[model samples]
Target: MGLVRNRVGLPAKCDLQIKAKREVCSFEFHSVPGDKSISQRAIVLNAIAEGQGTVYNVLRSRDIESCITILRQLGVRIAWNGDELSVHGQGLRGLQAPAGRLEVGNTATSARLMLSVLAGQSFAAELGGNALLSARPMDWVVQPLTDMGAVIEYLGAKGCLPLRIQGASPLSPIDMEATVFSAQEKSALLFAGLYAEGITRYRQRCQSRDHTERLMHYFGIDIHSDNDVTFLKGGNAFCAKDVMVPGDMSSAAFLLAAYAIRGVDRKGSLLIKQVGVNPTRSGFIRLLAEMGLHLTLQAEAELISGEPVADIYCTPGTRLSSVLAEGNGRIQSLIDEVPLLAAVSAFAEGNTVIRDCGELRDKDTNRIQTTAGVLKAFGVETSCSDDEMVIHGGRPLSPAIVNSCGDHRIAMTAAVLASSLDEPSIIRNCGCINVSYPGFVEDLSQFAHIDVLPAE
Candidate 1:
């Protein structure tokens, strides 16, 4: 049989099988590239703004590149010089309708966020993506846009993608109530509301990440929130501003978990300098502390960018404890870290149960199941239902080959397990690690001895 090589030249198959006995070793990793989430937003916002916008330290990943492609298709002038990106936008309400269909691949953020901007236009547009992107829920955007008078149709599953949106008369103000608190949904409504008749009000169960609201304020747009409602007035023009995208806390969780499991100094603790510590996205930090992991945050000095930057110092400590739902809910602010946090749980002393993460189940059940699968391969007992994964720890993981299931987080978690194992193990679909951390293998090489063996 032949091996499969992915776009980034990662090994086709990553299977972890014990070729020898277990050996313990430690290593350190450096910082990763610019944040993916911020990169997507930066490109979209720059495309919609009036003047030239400069984005420094932008990530050039698949998802972010999808956003850049959509922006360019809509008549924006975008240039990239190394890590610096320059986008010349047509200002609010500046985009001319594209002559044909605009395809945004694999990235739901690109499809959803850009759809909102498209809603305000006096033209028609169709949005489609890769199989996975088309499968993601779009009713989140459909419901609000339809309520505000935008015409949209789901070409596939009821609320899912393969969307055909015919731009309508600019939206009328909406006193909207959301069925779920999704940042993409909220941001979509806010973008569509920019061309509405009056003030558009957003009400949801709880607050989401708030990147949209914060960026609104940054661009001199009129926005306000009270209780559970956020308001955006129509007839507003957003000014282009230079943005400094910081390191992602979500990405930082991998390094933190590696440090906590393998002993930071023993494996050489990683320093992720000047990462975005947006309170909404720091739940992992809080949850780790609550679970009794030792992590130090330094350089809390404020930056001119309106977001806080800090140095993260993490060292391995005693087996961390499980988090309760009430506490987990408090840190639900950073829900994306739950999967990697499960890996940390596998190395903990007691049962580490994760609940109130039902939202995650809907997005990547295959990936989550892969986490449980990897844990089982390493001799960690785990129980997973639709919503949560319960782990029983304190058992040293045995060396075994596992699958990454085409998920980057899963690939990295498997790598972490491989680092602490004495025997050579295989991780199938290891190429998935390129989705987020492109240099993951190189960084992981610093921690443990890993061979890029070809698949059978």
Candidate 2:
């Protein structure tokens, strides 16, 4: 099955319209899509477990679909009966090699995580992706796997995709401190560790998302984390359990930002229900709070899957302030939301400087450059560098046509920013929003003036 596209009468490549004259973003409660990170892991990890596992509340986005499709290609049996996903695993050593090349279009998460699963398999498998996914940095994942005895050949370009991967049986485990803050890389090595005999140790300077670690424990794998260190015991088998995915906080940020802005058509608190508010993953909330947006959380019972869910309450701010984004943990937490933060900062009183963002250049397009485009579309100006952005706020937003850069986040950010101003604006190539948040245009249109149409 292909990735799900936008369902609100949108063409493959569509444009988004945001008119500020629509109903204000006032509501008592809302729910976004299921957590994409958790949903992907729940599907991939459980598919390799010893028995059949059922996953609930899975996000049926294009990215998750990519992971599911690739896993099915690798011989896992997965079926969706209504909202429940039934995945039957052949255990740690039972995964079958695909008959042909595995195609993962525009899904870096699926491609990267699947690399580790394929790394320890006995046979060679070829993995390829679309043009955008091919350009992402796979060397970060490859070099580490190569160190562990996996034989990887680059079919296209070095450090890029279209790779021919051959497994290394009884792979060598190593102890090293991670130089990059990547949960995907960390998860890949952890998966590789499952094939090795000894204990595998991974250390990081700061915590990224811990969903992988959490899910490992949920599946009964012998994995533990202390401070910045993580240890995984190899040669262990695990069983499957029913997993519940919480609502996506990343998706909630756009709505909360609309209500939190000073002069949007909003007057009250926006309640977002049943969101995964994991501290390491919910840094966007803290980033907003730092800029004087009022937000509170009512905690929900932790899922047996180790995901923490909560209801978020956000009130629009009267006075906004500048923010500084630094440190590895802070950078990782708000990484996906930086573009949205930049768009929201345009109405703040001062310059919001974001640093430690060199990784932004590695996204679908150059996110740093695209975020600059977003800020400019909002009539905000500032200085930009390879790793830093200073958004000058308090400027009058203009009615402009902004390019989506073929990026879902950029398109969503532009649309969210435009909803707060009186002028109507257009975001080109917004159909990309379905990559992560399908039906986003329809969701936004209920509270804001937005429409999806064929791209010019």
Candidate 3:
């Protein structure tokens, strides 16, 4: 077997064993786990709401656990009974200060967005994270927050983690534009706007996720989007509302690629139920359709907690053709799913070009280069650049020895590619998958046999 080494200095955890048949049997179920993005938002928004809030289908993952843990430390009452989540609101100005530094684990989403909320509280608090989270840049979210009167003191590196923040009540609301296409940055601004007295306006570099915007509106916050611009009216107390989080689109994308590529020559279709179909997060769906995947979404989509929910049905075996997946316009939506696309595209009849992927550098690893390395390890020829990757497809694949490098998506993507062959693929450091989709191995088991081996 060919080897692709782990380069990010990740300690050995466990090996993921997945060997999928060349063809998959059709299956359908009611659940696919909750959306991580929506789950984190629901936990925070409802925690600071005016009354008690009930959240249905919140994903129990490491990333989301960070949000819940921090909220509890801030004196918010949250209870989850395995099915439903209940959060007692602290109102708009009620969160108590933690005893010391609030240590948020490896979740960057939890750290950045939570900092924005912390900026509106009435205490000076310090936020810290694990080594991985500490290395990421927080400037995009911090700068906007500072402009709104939040005093930020970096205890470590500038714009990185482990910092103290002092929030301003009646923070000055301002119209601002983002230099990066980031949903988190937009959400950081809007969430802090609740403490401001006037309207806070935000502009994006490109269209990104809008779960924050939609959830704000759901909880009776005055927020609206005109074209790509969003505005939030401040000083409004939130009314506790029930939120039903849809299944994660990011997780669903992995399932879709695995079954779709293998299903092409099989009978029957796989039905993925009640997954998010937000247009802002549907770039991969559009791209796959353009690549000739046989897919159908329910015509009558349901709206849950301000997000579109639909049952997506797919039958594999359609010949895939490569289409340009450019970054500027579609990167925000596809950033989390590009690895899956690039890996599955190895079966496509032509060369697949993914351009302007520089944003991937800021992920847990340099995913752009890491993805190229994984593909090459599987005997797929690839041309990689700083901002672009071209995968030469339509060739036979060999068994591969790959590493996740602590990236969940990269591991899952490589496993999906391995499932296409008769031999199993060994993925090191798969514990990282718990950060996002804890149920992924079970879900993928529908198409293959998975073995969780002890780390040496």
Candidate 4:
């Protein structure tokens, strides 16, 4: 099957209407989509396992769909029933050489992780992506895999996408320290190490996301992590098991920010059900709670597929205080949610500063530049250096036109900022929101005065 465009786009025709701010007390509850991080990892692990397995509640967004399409092209059989996904594996060595190029449209996770999986196979294949995906840095993954005996050549840009990879059998294991803090890079090494001849050890300067490691342990792989170091044994086999992906915490952050700012005036409480509150991915929740928002964990946490899942309960709060986002370790946890948090900071009681976030420059767009521009469009005073953003909160915001920069998180963040405005505003390139949350506009409309209009 060919990759599908989820929505059409118009340059200036589409306009978002943001009604005047009012007390929104109507009762609101929503079940967001499955975690994209977990869904992507589960699909990869299941495809490489020794037996068939079912993954329940998988996210059905562009990113997850890209994983499905790429896996199918590599000769893996995957069946989809509603939100349940069944994968029939051909073991670690079972993937056949694709008849043609594997297209991963705009999904960095799929491109990076799958490159590692293909490194150990005894064939040659080319991986290509759309314009946005082609610009993202692949050297972080390529250099490591190349060091371990994989032959990877750049078909286009030296360090970018359109790669030609020749599989390396009996891969060599190496002891390396990650110069940059990236879970994708670390995961790529670990995945390739699964097929190596010996143990592979990796130490990170700061802790990155642990979804890959957790999923590995869930599948019975011999993996362990202590401090900032991780050890994985090669020549191991994977046994598939049933996995239930919880609601994405990143997608849930927009709702939490909405209620945290507007819920106090509403008559009912706001509850988001069964979200994956993995510590590595829960920085936004913790930061908001620390900012004096009445957020709480309502149920005991459950461990599913090595991830922590729980129900999140939030009641309206009177005000929000500023919090600092610095340090290498803490920034990696909330990296994706910084734009949302920056938008929310416009109405806080004090100035909010986010530092050690230069990595934002390397996303689908320059998030640091786009986020500051969006805040400025809404009449919020913001300033940014190379790796830091400072928002002077407690300022009045005005209705204005903003741009999404074709980034999904930027589009969602703009929508949230528009909700609290005194009048309506427009957000350009809003259709790109489907990359992560296809139901974002529909779900938020149930609780806020927001409307999605097609380009005229």
Candidate 5:
């Protein structure tokens, strides 16, 4: 494989060098990063619980850091000693008014979930983020919280951040009907419902990630799910306890994809330890298996904090074929991995269609367009519409410079794709990978020859 460089000559935090068709002759065991979703939820719930709580194996990334920073601004006492995070819960109504606006950085998870928590407080505060976050819509949470009698005003463009919220001491119970299958929206409402006067019922056509529900149950909160609906009664007390966050499945998806695309050639097997395989978030594994990837679940599968945990083993499959990924109710489970999946589709035998995923456009960047752009740069035939992406597979990828668009998933996906190609490809804005998987370059380096250098 030959090396390629970016033509823009822009300075970057990290540049990756991936040798194509690299073979790994030895078995590999990797301990991926802790689950960011669970870590964020644990931090928020622990801060509002009734006593002191400890979270182990929490991810140390920019996204998690944003959550910690906002919690501290709201009077939650949080301390980090290496891998252990300790939080002193002040109870549901115990949060003090922030002295200044809460800066959420570029994390939509922090912005949306924290917005709901702020709605039940008794003081007024402002929520803000970076330029990228400021462009993503916040109306999904704002509209529902407003219906429950929480006063929120958009400080910037309508339906987006920065938001000025005047909280209600006793929020009104809401019968919310979800218009989209979004985990962030559902979790936000459930979080705010803790302060309502009666039961807050959320009904959706499809299920999203249930981390909030599971963590609530783990912390002794009263929450239940019926068909198409999750209801939480207000005034339930949360008891503080220690939580051990499992390894992030989303981060593991990149590794799994790398092995799926190249393991047959490398003649090696990969084992990822202590990964959270929550059914609602395991769509990547399920979908990849359907597309002819061989994966095994170790016998140690168990439950952690009401979530499923297991070790994932990946090996090369006999053949690769295309599969359909529609944006039905199940899209929430695999939303973060769609970009990586699209990249892998380049190695399949037939056309892969990803439809009904217009929601990808609303992320940190236009993921559907960005995913297609990356594949196209590598000489793959791809096309994208408002709600669908089609990748014509069976074509060998060529070396070319690809842009990460300042998005972490895209950066990691590009790196994975580059590793499988026959020539070297440059990934611009590679440092954005730190937002979710700061250790991605380091972890992937174990299996392949990679070099990290300054962009220019």
Candidate 6:
């Protein structure tokens, strides 16, 4: 209950307070958005290829919608009903030049991937995005595609967006090494490799998500990876299949973190069913499990949809141990979950050192810095370098006002911290949760005391 104002005799702002319950409460069932990353890739690949394909369980987020809009501008017909999306793909040589500029707002994947394909076309196309996307580094995508004989001209800043890709003759395949560990950059090259004259091979310094490769294979595109090197030969036809996108594991991270921190009852432990559990993207889960989280993976199966799916059941369990993030697939898989994992570390017993995630430093470095700042704001002692964060754990967390910085993972992470508190904690700029899971606040309201307040 909020304090009443005596002068006006009316209620003022609502104050949220978490009360201690005698019994433990847990979540039994919950569902999140359709895989946003997968949906974006599915739409882009199917729309640009030479087949009529149906994509089911597509996420209807703002980013994905931007991709669809761009595809439509490129003369691809898209029919969508709820989560079911059908793309009448324009063949390799089927695209017509759009009359005006095509804008992709804050969707880096859409902007980057489409730029690669547009490079292979024979028309001049301009691509731009919102402030955030414009500020994102495109040189990783630009340099590789340019080396493949795509002439891209940057109109605004060097190696940034508001760029123009004047379609020139597609060049023969060239072996290149990806400098940054960005899945989008790798996928962009691979997508261009689909139309290259000869074989195109990509060697990466670090492994990123392989959804693009998995989807290409599912579409009958031959893409082979030997160790860290991926080879894709040109002159191949893509056979589209009916893809069923599972729930996004990234989105599920918040629920698992909340349940772990809040200590849900046995019966109410939220069953996040049928989520994409591709081994390449399970680093966070692996870390949590290593830290002693009571997580269960059931009905695990491989899908020809280019990704893997399984049922993830997470209930309340003992506090986890501090985990040191090692190299290999761990950093690449959980690139987006670093913030939440950092919060998880706050409750652990030892020192947690997350290292070798330098690639993440390219994008949202401020978020990483802000995450460390928030930990300090919450009374948790932490330190972070450019590429790593070391958090000393087993510290008591007190209620404090924290800023989300408009990052979805950070916002949800703050909410998870709120759930564990006996007192009220205010989260400003937390509305960014809609970037992925729009129902976050509504769904969370069922479990904890949450009041959605405007940023003051």
lDDT of 4 by residue, 29-88 (tens): 446788998899898999999899999988888888889999998889999998899999
Candidate 1 regions exceeding 4 Å error are 1-30, 263-265, 325-331, 364-367, 453-456
C-alpha local distance difference test of each model: 0.71, 0.81, 0.82, 0.83, 0.84, 0.76
lDDT of 5 by residue, 1-456 (tens): 111111122233877878654555543544668899999999999899999999998888888989999999888999999779999999998999999999999899988888888899889999999898999999989998998888999888999999899988788999988877777888899998998988999997687888889999888888899998998998766788899998899988987887777747565666777889998999989988899987888946656588778888767767888999886655677989988889889989999998878888999899999999999998999999988899999887888788788888988888998887666778877877878887777566655667776774
TM-score of each: 0.90, 0.95, 0.94, 0.95, 0.95, 0.91
Better of 3 and 6 by lDDT: 3
Give the range of the ten consecutive residues with the poorest summed lDDT in model 1.
1-10
Which rank order by TM-score, best down to worst?
2, 5, 4, 3, 6, 1
Tell me how far the alpha carbon of residue 57 in candidate 5 is from the true structure, in angstroms, after superposition: 0.9
Model 1: residue 446 alpha-carbon error in angstroms: 2.1
164-269: candidate 1 lDDT, tens digit per residue: 8877666788887877655767778888888787899988667677777776777777888897889999876777778877777776777676666664335434
lDDT of 2 at 326: 80
Model 1 RMSD to the real structure?
4.4
Q: Which of the two, 2 or 6, has more lDDT?
A: 2
Q: TM-score of predicted model 5?
A: 0.95
Point out where model 4 deviates above 4 Å: 1-15, 20-23
lDDT of 4 at 118: 93
- Winner on TM-score between 1 and 5 is 5
lDDT order of candidates, top first: 5, 4, 3, 2, 6, 1
- Model 1, residue 163: what's the lDDT? 74
The local distance difference test score of model 4 is: 0.83
State the displacement of the C-alpha of residue 125, model 5, in Å, after optimal TM-score superposition: 0.7
Which run of 10 residues does model 6 get worst, by summed lDDT? 1-10
Pairs that clash in candidate 5:
none
